[model samples]
Target: MSKYIIIHVFVRIFSNMQENSKDPITQSNEQCSLTMVRRVAAMLDLDSKSFSEGDLLPKGWHFFMLAGETRKSELRSDGFPGLGVPIPDLGLPRLLLGGRTVSYNGDIVIGSVVEKTSFIKSIVEKTTNSGPMAIVTIQHELRPISETSPAIIETQTYILLSASKASNNSEKTLSQPIEAEHQKNIIPDETLIFQYSALGFNSHKIHLDRSYAQNSEGLPDLVVNGGLTTLLLTEYIRTNLGLEITDIKVKHIAPLYCNRPMTLTAKKSETDWKLYVYDNNNDIAVEAEINVK
Candidate 1:
């Protein structure tokens, strides 16, 4: 059969799963709101044109978190290893992705609409085995405009730069100094690292499968994805930076492995805030700057 036919068949099978899932992500006190679900879906369906018309649930805007003027400026800065600057790109490290994560924290029952917002967190320039890399992050929050409790929606993202654009580096050791406004520790272990990798559906050898990563990627065991670290830092800002995060940007500096503990911090500058997911030994796992309303 043609690939399209196979895809159509798979779509039908997944439709049943959605129908069968009664309150897929259980709510604390109330039944899952159908109205809220529709609202989320509608927002996801909106486009740039509708966004220009007015507020349409803030969908595509989140994708811009990975690209912007600030991100471009930082890429051209001197902290990076290469003599020349790199291109500013968007989307996941893996282009064709499985959409964004929808971590259901609470349900906005049917007939209810929740307010949504997003923000750019921070940007960092780092030298990796592949050369200079940028990990941009965006934070999103979904809260009922009215009395909504025990149910909240939140997500942070990490985007990797294309490997081809990385400075041509045959050497694995990063030869650059990472400047930081704040200091943090990186304490990683098997359990925390493994759990995060699993939740993100990341099959990259550098994340799990230690032997392959060490032999092929030439890393210690398995290296952590900067995107996940940026997500964690973006989450920190959502919980602390008030309720008006509209965008976020983050960059990756160094690699973090399992069995290491790291410190996460957030700072503000005017309407923007910076978050750090830093490692004590290797320096920074990822640095993010968030824009708040």
Candidate 2:
């Protein structure tokens, strides 16, 4: 697909994006430095040895080191990384990825160094179709280590609530009665979880350590990275639809664990496609929309 066509589609998604326009955001930043990008290439199963650090980082690869960590070394029983930043103690224990928006300025080429400045854009207590929840919105801007122009900007929202909170995924369960126009069945394994964790610089033990996940966190299985599921959605559009994705926004609905049958489904709309991923239980794990004009 032509670049111009993708740009037009991105514009439409941006127009309908769920972002609050407010001011005086809490700000802090970290360097996209070190050989981190190299590790990122390994996580993606890409051979960066042949490519230099200054070379433009590939699309969909911009999600590296997005979660800047807290200096403290301890973690809550649920494993929310103690990134020194102050996350509101919403009095909630569990964390779910609500949604995210990646505004692609261009391929983020990490020169000798790069910088990512983040902002606590907003935090709202709201009632969703599911139940009561606290939504935390964080914004990240990526640019050259010494430049002012941004190569990319991402607005990521996290939802904090009780683990036992009700979800409609199980209530409206379907064995995929309607055949999807396009879909991919992927049974993710521990190896994919490990590699993706390595790629995204995610150190959450719930994702890497199976015993810790089940014993400590009280989870049935090792958790899958929300980012990886979102990546699958974009890849489905690219490889299956022959479209270039400039933006991706997703609201995770349920948890997806390893060794389960997970399927990605997409259906066509007027200018975009209704996208989703289903867990082994056949409940929607993620709810999303893709725009490819």
Candidate 3:
């Protein structure tokens, strides 16, 4: 049998298992605490050595990356690749992120416990020239060491990269130019969250463990992850333009914060699409170009 057929069979069996299995409650109303952040951060590879001398990550960022990596792991055990790795079977449900929303309550300090809860919000499937891809949405909530108003809530979109197009450096031939846009929505924040160093399994620290972020990373505060921003931009385009994005490349210019709102801008020139996420302050958080056919 062909590899694609084998992968498709596995995906079918896995999907059936998912449908028959008991649905677990993935969402929580709890506030983010320091302890919870610490545990999750450690698993994600966040540690003390990662911090810079002064500037560092804020609190909410920690919860963001943790939930993302955790979600990836969950999908893998059900028959997919883990985070940062391409999926094996080309026939499996190709998951890709569309966008996310994260609310920030207050700051999480070092040695503090953060209250966190997460849930799967939505899942959708689409057929592309490459194959079938599934979009999975998940939500996460975070709070201060002490319970307070405006707890941070984050929604994330995950895209399971299709295996059919699998190859070393699979994104090489997918490059294109930026499109044009007039009106756009942007989110802004002052102290962007960031990872202190190559601390944890997480190369995306702007999303995890804030202590190192603030004191070590040299960032004003904890910064949001560039990857998350890309996900949001892709999600925005998919919803607004309804285009099948074969590949995307994004470049980060500045950092984003916990509660800040970012704008997503898009335009089309010839056969390519250009998109950007701007911080509320009007700074370019990230820029991306997509090839859609």
Task: Report every candidate's CA lDDT.
Answer: 0.43, 0.67, 0.47
Each model's TM-score? 0.41, 0.74, 0.39
TM-score of 3: 0.39
Compose the digit string of candidate 1's lDDT tens values, residues 6-38.
211111111232245231222112222433333
* lDDT of residue 268 for candidate 1: 64
Candidate 1: worst-modelled 10 consecutive residues by lDDT: 5-14
Ten-residue segment with the worst summed lDDT in candidate 2? Answer: 7-16
Candidate 2: residue 126 lDDT (0-100): 59
**Best candidate, lDDT-wise?**
2
- Tens digits of per-residue lDDT for model 3 on 1-293? 44443222112212322245343333333323344444434533457345432232342345333432435345432222233322234455333334444444444455444555554555555565466666555555555446664345555566654533222121123234323463345442322223322222333332454554454344444456555465456556654667655556566555566665566788786877777776656555577777665
RMSD (CA, Å), candidate 1 to true, equals 17.4
Q: Total clashing residue pairs per candidate? A: 39, 3, 68
